[model samples]
Structures are given as structure tokens and as C-alpha cells.
Target chain A: MGWISDFLLLNDPTLRVVVPGVLLLCGMSAAVGCFTFLRKKSLIGDAVSHSVLPGICIAFILNGEKNIFYFLLGAMISGLASVLIIDYLTKSRFARNDTAIALMLSVFFGLGIVLLTYIQHQGNASQAGLDSFLFGKAASLNKDDLMIFGISSLLIFLLIAFLLRGFSLVSFDDSFAMSIGFPVVWLKSLLSVLTVWSIATGIQAVGVVLMAALLIAPALAARMWTNSIIKMLLLAGIFGMLSGYSGAFVSYALPQMPTGPWIVVMASVIAFGSLLLAPRKGLFSQIIERNNNEKKILQENILKIFYHIDEKSGETQKAVLQEDLLNQRSFSNRNMRKGLRILERKNYLSNHLGAWSLTSSGRVEAKRIVRLHRLWELYLQEYLHLDPDHVHDDAEAMEHVITPEIEAQLDVLLGNPTIDPHQTQIPSKDE
Target chain B: MNSNDLWIVFTAIAVALICALPGCFLVLRRMAMVGDAISHAVLPGIVIAYLLSGSRNTMYILPGAAAAGMLVTVLIEWLQKRLRVQSDASIGLVYTLLFAIGVILVTAFTAQTDLDQECVLYGEIAYVPFDMMSIVDGGFSAPRQLWIASGLLTVLIIVITLGYRGLYLSTFDPGYATAIGISVVFWHYILMSMVSLAAVVSFESVGAVLVVALLTGPPAIASLFAKRLPLMLLLACVFGVLACVFGYLIASFLNASISGSIAVVIGVLYAFSLVIKKIFF
Candidate 1:
């Protein structure tokens, strides 16, 4: 390993040549991957990659085996053609986008297979290197291949920077961007070409079949953690680079291990990690928030009963049986104890001889919750045209959730109604 | 050309008919890619059978190819469901990988044989007739690819025709079919296996790419002019025969590879059909 590093540094097998070269190419790829992810067009890469097979084969037939330049050019043309055909067909009536991509991917790749078979039949030794292009053999890549990748990565970075705003605007809202004088159609065509270029650049290292994952995985992973376009782009690039390096390292660690699928696996791990743990949008945060909300609601439920009993008879001193309240709720006695503790802490209700009653502060909180609930029910029934039965269930949930501004607004809008639709009293301010 | 020349066309027609029978269903199910996938995947199966038998026995290779085809179907389906990746991505991933593996193994193991990847692609259907079958005292018999293909096509046509209503109902709207109590997955597997078997038989003659074209193009061409299922299937057979016969003759006259030219011509024909339908209709 040390000797290899020494060689790459001194134009031998040293770290200087290998590490920096890999870093530059991997960094640019991950950056382009960010845009691809935000656009949600992963499979476009799949269509383009599979489409390159015949191109390389045709190049060999026409130019003989030695010309990497012509072969790569041919590969790029056919790869772009696959993308165009997919876009053209999917935009039409009969076929869907996914299905169109799948069809073209198979057909062109099949054609490439047939041609490669012919090349193999002739017993040319050059055909030996062709299969490596399927899953990508980054280690087999030489200084010549590295130069092509370096130039392509630079071109991609420059092009993206030049059109950053235009891409973002068009990606988010094509119609709005068009109205504002952007060439939405032309810009989109440019993006499509970029996708093909991305596919072509990665083909030598990642190979055809697995290059789609590189285009898709980093972008997908980036989306999990951000809303800001710049942040998303940056994060996506980071994920892409890390996945590339890690996939490269893993392949190095295990001899003969394919780079493309492993890179994809690494990207997927990034995506899944963000999916479970990213702030605000993370699944765990959402679940915890929801659980806390439900706990708070259960505590409020006990205070509500006391307010209800006093409302019917204007008898504030009645001691309602805890057993009776338990029957009315779906919560078990264990849950009720927790609720009672929360209620007692707030001085909402006190337990006396196993009976529950609300204190004065509790009565005010209960009346307000009930008022907000009925207001929402009225709002839904009036504005949204919901069924009264549906309104009750919805309002029951919304009642405790309205803010002070919403409560005031509803009060003014409803003309301070004394009774709800069910002939029950709709409590007001100062009640 | 004599009456014997008719056998060449007749045997081709028989092989084409068998391929087209399940092709109609494949096109309808949108499993046309699977037809191509299984066709290429059959390389390993044929290679394995050849290894064990030391002979290219139709008895051995038929099941071998079909088994390999089904394995691909199972692999793609399993990967798609288990990985939560999109179906198209999974299909593309599985087939290319399996095909590549098959290609590598072929070159590595049977390097001595003339069975290169290109022969596997277009297949030597023109050469199918020469493979020595059981020679009789009375008369000469056809190579069994024709007979086996004919039988498979017949069984496929019968199965599809019998279950036509159920198949159509599910294909048209599986959600609606399920709502009406049809077991979609049961009918689905039947179509998968039928298409797999058909593609396997056709692979040795037409090769893989043409399998996709035959499966998709004829039905697509028929769909342009015909509305009924029976009409579509029948016209597709006519279109299939036309593609095979005309495709072969044109390729032979040009001295081009039969399967590549046939597939390209089918693409051209499909495009032409669309153009004509557009301009006239």
C-alpha cells in the first residue's frame, strides 16, 4: 500500500496521482448528482447507461479496438439518443415514462449485447475489457481515462454554476418560470443533455448497468435533509462524494467486488439514515411529537368532563365518579391516573373520594377548549360544507388546538353565538 | 425455389407463430422486456445444458432455457419487491447483471466452442434446420425447434384463448378486476411463465432483441387497426409472419445478420405503421 502511494505521488502508483484524481472526479460527480436527485429523475440515467453498449461495440466494428476516443464518442451519442427516445415516447399517449425507459433500456442494451457477441465471436482480445463497462471497474481506469473524466467533471461544474438559478426556478415551477420569460422548454432540454453527459462520464468507471444508481442515489439521499435549494445541492454533493469514495474503498477492500452497486448501497444508506433521523422531517421526531400531543390531549380530557357537568345544571360543585368518566373514554384506568396527575399539576381538577371535579382555573380552560371546538365545527359546516356528523368528530379534535387569534377571529365571524347547532351552549369569553 | 423452400418459410412461420402466441400476452402485460431478458438469460442455461449433456439436445436446452428464464423473472420480481426500488430499475438491474454473468461464464467456460455472444444474440435460425435430428428410412424430419415451437405456441394460444376474458379483464384494469373478485396474481404468474417459455423457444431461432420486437411491435401494429382481442392476436400473427418472412428475405438478400436486420426492420415497420395511421386516420 505504501509503495503504491509512493508510485501515485511520483507518477508511479502514489497517492498524489490516485487520491487527488479520484477526489476531483468523485467530488464533481456527487455535485451533479445533487441536481439529479432534486429533479427526481434517477431512471433517466438507467436509460442512458444501458444505451451505451452498442455505441462502444459499433465503434470497435468501424474503427477497430484501439481507438478509445471514437468509441467513447459513439457511446455518448447513443446514450443521449436513448434519453431523447425515452422522453419522446413517454410524452406521447400510449406508454408511461417508467415503462418507456424500461423498454428502451432493455432494447438498446439487447442490441449492444448482440453486437458485443459478434465482436467476441471474432476472437478479438480487445472485447475482453468491454464487460467491465457494465458494472464499472474504476481500478482498471488509467491516466488517459482519468483525463477525460477530469475534463468532463469540470465542464459539468461550470455549466451547473452558470445556470444554477435557471435550473432551480424551472425545476420547482416550470409554468411560473415560463411566464417570467425563462425558456422553460430549452432549459429542460439542456438538463436532459446534462443527464446523458452524467451517464456517459461515469460509464468507464461505474459501467452501464449500475451508473443509474450513481445518478440517482446521492440526489435522493440529499433530499431527505433539506428544503433550501443551495443546501440541498451541497448536501447531495457531499453524499455523492462519500458514497463514491466508500464504494471505491469497499471494492478495493474486497477484490473483484463491483463498484457501482456498492456505491449505490452507500448512497442508499445515506438516504435511509436521513429518512429516519433528519431534523423536523425525520420519522422519529414526527412520532415523538405525535406521542407527546396525544399525552397532552388525554390530560385535558378529564378537565373537560368537569366543565361539561357544571354547564348542564350550572352546578359547579358536583363530584363526578372517576368510574363514570372512565366509561365515557377509551383510555384505561392506568392512562387516567397519568391524566389526573397532569390535571392536578395545573390545578385543573382535584380527586376527592375517588370522584373528579374541576377547580376554577380548570373550569376556564375547559370552557375555552369547548368553545374553540364548536367554533371549528360551525366553520366546517358553513364553509367547507361538511356533514354535521363529520364536523363533530373534526371539531372535537380542533377545539383544543385553535390559537387566541383564531378564537377571536371565529368569535367575530360567528357573531358571538350563544348556542351551537346541537342546542348545546357555546361558551363565550368571560364565561 | 421449390416446395421445399416452402418448408423453410413454413418452419419459420411455425417458429414465428409459437413466438407470437405468447407475444400478444407479453405486449399486453407490458412484460415485453422480460421476453428480451429471459432470451439473453437463456445463454447460461444453454451453456450449462451443453456442459452436462455434451450435446445440444433439444430435450435438455428447452427446459434449461425456460428454467433460466423463470429464474430471471423470479430474481427481478424478488429484487423489486424486497429492495423497494422501482420495478423498471429492478428489471434493468437484474437482466443486465444476469446477462453479463451469462456472457462472462460463456466466454470463460466454453471458449473452445464457436458459441460467442453474437450467436447467442441473433441466434442461427437459418442454421436450425441443419442440426441433425433422428433420420428415418422413409423421409427426413424437421429440426425439433420447429415442432417444439409449434406445440408450445398451440398450448399458449389455447390457454390464452380459454382464459381470454379473465386475462383481458385483468389487463385492462387489474384494480377493477380485483374489485370484481379476480385473483390478479394467479393470472399474472400464468402469463409470466407462458411468456418465459415462449421467449426461451424463440431465443435459439430469433434471438433476444427480436423477441422484444415480435412481442411488442406486431401487437402494437395490430392495435392501431384492430380493436378486438382476437383480431389483435390474429393480425399480430400475420404481422409476425410478415416480419419474419420479409425480414428474413430482406436480410438474406442484403447478406445482413438475420435477427438484427429483422429487429431493425420491425422497428422501421412499427414506425411506418404509426406514420401511416397518423397521416390517414
Candidate 2:
């Protein structure tokens, strides 16, 4: 309880400075990240982050001091240069975008490394802790840094809010947006500027090496949960803030740990968790749905087999031996017994002496299944002009999925046909 | 140059050639970032292997790091295929996640050890010549990195020689190769394994960050200048050797970090080539 209060109370001044700054930075980056992810330009964020390193080094060299404003300005300038270089490479047909990104990323980072080493050799006391830009030093963030982040974060939020429609339009359909007179190019540049701003602001916390993760992971996680862009932005912002808070807490607890990598680690867990467990599109849910579908198909096939047995005997009800079913279809014996037991529990089958007979209630279900099968067969032969033999296979597959409503529509559409193309009598309703 | 300087330059050249060889295939496949992924992803493997085996033996660390490298490839593939994450996004996601885990593990267990994160990021290649391993019971000795890099270089040469045809077929036109009954999937894993091996070996000398630059930069420059495969391979090696020679010279004169200078030198060479090609062609 004491530890919880200590963590959550925000009594420490460092926490007050670090927490809001990281949260705002993460939320803004994640929001802008949605557009980049949709644009399939995720790695471009990576290139831009690395490109900013030389910018910071060059700024420190030029100013002979570590000023936050100069750093941000230098970062934005180099960030824009990286984007322009990538654009030139691909647009001029010199290299593919990925190659261009990789090229720019490594080259700029190398230059930054060289410049950084030079600064270290000069033995300037002001250059102390400057290398933290490689892997950030979030704990050193002060009230002034927080103020900068606060203003920039607010500006990014309002910009994204105001331009949501334009961003989405351009992201989803660039040519369509252009055709609709939405100033697609201007919208694109605006979004790029927003991305560059967030990245420049973020480098002080997350650093250049892992900045792309902050820009991408939250949105990647949020996209797994919802299809709507608005929900995606909201959820991503929430995830980013949660990760930011937790990362700061953990880093504060353990003195050796860096907050930037920890934050990314937390975001990844949420993203992977969402991918594996989110409803509708997640891996686990999809597996469950597929298994249920297979089970349903098995149950329907068992019912159809029982109807065929009664039809062959031309009797109202007949008890068929278990061996007879095994010879009719090649399903597993274990599955056959289980299906029989399930049917019996439903009051759809009666079993005595290892022979199964369809009860009255079961007869009605079996009759409907056969009716759907034969109706589909007739519809295919008459309406689609498919061969009578081909219609049987098509109808066999379609019968299980045809709902009661669809069955009624098919009956009306087929003019209440009494016999199928094979001259088999279609079971009437309530018969 | 003195003998120590010669060994350092040799170590750099060996690391360069080993990385640039497979890097050509990566660049051709448009998977230049995969090299970046493997470099960072190998961190956890190195740490865990050291913790488990209680030795910094290459035999133990190499397999552990190589396995970690394979995990990066497999995880990226799984996310893209099963979760429907975009390919580039999956690459970005998996490597960072693995890398962050590696960073945490290092800070947690090996904080006191010499395997600090700073050394891992930009390795001290100038220190390579100081760690000499005796080859013949103190009769003949070489730098440890020289032995590992050259041995790996020899193995790489053998693998490429034996499997050259299949590697070329799969990398260029996997669909065509698959249609013609070549095992494209099999070749892909083979290439990935080789990439993992090269990345781990290079990790010792160049460190992780510059390994990406070394693996990708030279070959990227090579692709711009060469039309034929053999020519590209030759040009990549030449460019790598040149970067090492010039980078070491510049670093020695300035008393700066050799690896950092080498990376800058490669970028300079790339830009230099770009200009030359522009002017001539």
C-alpha cells in the first residue's frame, strides 16, 4: 500500500516533470502514427528518427552549448532533409523506398556517431550527458523540458483533431482525395510536419534508436481492436499514455533501467496481447470460430445421414445400427458415437441395442435439413442451369448455412416446387 | 603501418567482407532492414548465453545469438502471416520488442560486467588488436577477432560456393524458383541462418549499430556501380576494404573512435560514388 501510494501520489518533483512529459509525447506520437501506419510508411518513421541524431550533434557543435530549442530546430531540419532524400531516391527511380530508408538511416546515424565522438574528444563540460540522445535519459527531463513537450503535444493534438478528416481521406484514398479536391499534397505535407515535430520532441525521452516504436507500436496495438479510425486514435493515445506511465514508474523503481526501451517493451506487450486476444480478428478468437464451424458441419452431416437412412427404407421411422452408419460415411468412430449421444440428449434420437432411430422431434429437424438440400438442388438446376449432378454437390455444401429466413425466400423464389430435379419429394413445412 | 594497426585493419576488413557478402542478397531482396533487425536482436542471446554458460566463449555465444537472430526472422514472419500486420510494421515491431528485452536483461543481470550497452552499441574496434589468442601454444598468435572473422569468412565462402546456384535462384525470383520445383522456403531459411551467423561475428568488432551500416552501406554502394552479380560482389568487398582503410587512417589521425569513423567513411564513400556516377553517366 505504501509503495502504491508512493508511485501514484506524484509527490516526487522528478515524477511530476517526467510523467506528464512522457505521456504527452507518447500520446501525440501514437496519434500521428496511425496515419503513417496506414500509409504503409512505417519504416520512414525509423529513418527520420535516426536522421535526427546528426541534427542534435550538429546543433550542439554550432551553438557550443546544449539548448533544447536549438536541438529541436536542428532535429526538424534534419528530419525534413531525411524525408526529402528518401523522396528523391524513390521518386527519381534510383532505389526502392525501403532501401532508401535503410541507406539514409545508417548514413545519418554514422555521421551523428562521428560528430558525437568528436564532441566527446573536445572535452567540453557542457557536452556532458549529451550522448543520452542515443538511448534517452528521461529522468533528467526538467520542468522547462516538460513545458516544451506540453506546448508541442497540445499543438499536435489540436492539429490532428482539426485535420482528422483530411488525414483520413488522404491515408485511405490519396487519389480519391485528390479527385475530390481535398488538397492531398498539402494534407500529406502537414501530416509529415506533425510527424517530424512529435519525433523531434520525443527524441529527448525515447531517443533516436527506438523512437519508431513509440510512433508505431501503440497504433499497431489499437488497430487490432477497432476498425474505425476515430476509435483507433483514441485507443492508441490511451495505450501510449498507459505505457508511458508504467515505463516511468518502472524506471524510477530500478535505477539502472532506461525508460525508453522499457516503454517500448510495455507497448509491445499490449500490441501482441491485442493481436492474440482481440475479438473478431484476433488469433485465438479466429481459431475458436473455425473449430465451432467444423463442429457444426459435423453435426449437420450426421443429421443428413439419418434422414437418408429413413428415406432408403421408405419407413416413417427406422432404427439404424451403428455399423450401418460407419459403412455409409468415413468419419471417425469416436465422432460418430459422440454425435449420436449429442442427438439423443437433444431428444432428436432414440437409441436401443446399439441401433439409432430418429424421434419425432428429430424427424422434423432432419426433414428441414433434407428440404433445404433438395430445394437448393432444384434452385441450382432451374435458376442457375447447372447440371443436375453438379447441383447435388453444390446443394450439399450450401444446405448447412441456409437459415430459416433464407429457406423461406428460396421456397418462394422457386415457386414452392414439390419435387427436385432428381424427382425426389421435397419435405413440406410442418410435415 | 605497424603490426597492431595491420591486425586492426585486417579485423575491420574481415568483418566488412563477411557482412557485405550476404548484405548484397539482402539489398537485392529489399530486406536491408533485416540486417538491422538481426544486429539488435542478438543482444539478448549474447547476454543469456553468457549467463548460462558462464563463459564468453564464441562457441556458446554464437549459437545463442544465431538462434536469437532466427527468432527475429520467425517472429516477423509469424506476425505478418498470422496477425496480418504489415510487413514493414512487423519488422519495426518485432526487432524493437526483442531489442528492448535485450536492453532490460543486460541492465538487470550484466550491469557490472564489461558487456555494457555502450560498448555493444558502438564497439571499440581499436581495442581488437590488444586481445590476442595464441594459435600454437604461444608460438604463433593472432587477435581473437581476426581468428573468428577469417574463420567465418572461410565458412561463408564455402557456403556460397556450394549453394550459389540455389541462393541466386531463390533471392531473385522466389515465385519462379518455387514454380520450377526449387525449395524457396528452404533456401530462405538457409540464407537467414547465414545472415544470423555473419551478424553475430560482426557484432564482436563493429558493435550492433555500425554492423547495420557495415552490412548494408557497402553493398548498397556496390549495387549502384555494378551490373553483374560477380562484379557487385567484388565491388562490395573492395568498397568495404577501402572504408576500413580510410576510416582507420582518419580515426588514428584524429584520435577518435575507429568504428564511428569507419561508418562515417563508408557514408562519405557512398556519397562520393553517387557524385561520380552522376557526373560520368
- Model 2 segments beyond 4 Å from truth? A378-386, A391-393, A403-414, A421-423, A428-431, B111-113
In candidate 1, which residue ranges exceed 4 Å CA deviation? A1-41, A87-99, A273-303, A310-322, A329-365, A380-391, A429-431, B1-159, B173-218, B234-269, B275-281
Query: So what's the TM-score on candidate 1?
Result: 0.73
- Per-residue CA lDDT of candidate 2, range B1-281, in tens? 99999999999999999988988888889888887888889988888888888888899999999999999999999988988889878999988888888878877876444577677777867788899997789677889988999999999889888888888899888889898999988988988888899888888687777888888888888988899877888899999999999999988887677887888888888888888888997
lDDT of 1 by residue, A34-137 (tens): 65545656556666877888888888888877466887788888988888777777676445554455557655775675576566667777668776666566
Best lDDT among the predictions, by candidate number: 2
Candidate 1: what's its TM-score on chain B?
0.89
* Candidate 2 collision pairs: none
Q: State in Å the error of residue A68, model 2.
A: 0.9
DockQ of each candidate's interface versus the true one?
Answer: 0.13, 0.69
Give each candidate's interface RMSD in Å: 5.5, 1.3
Provide C-alpha RMSD values for all models, in order: 6.9, 2.1
Model number with the top DockQ: 2
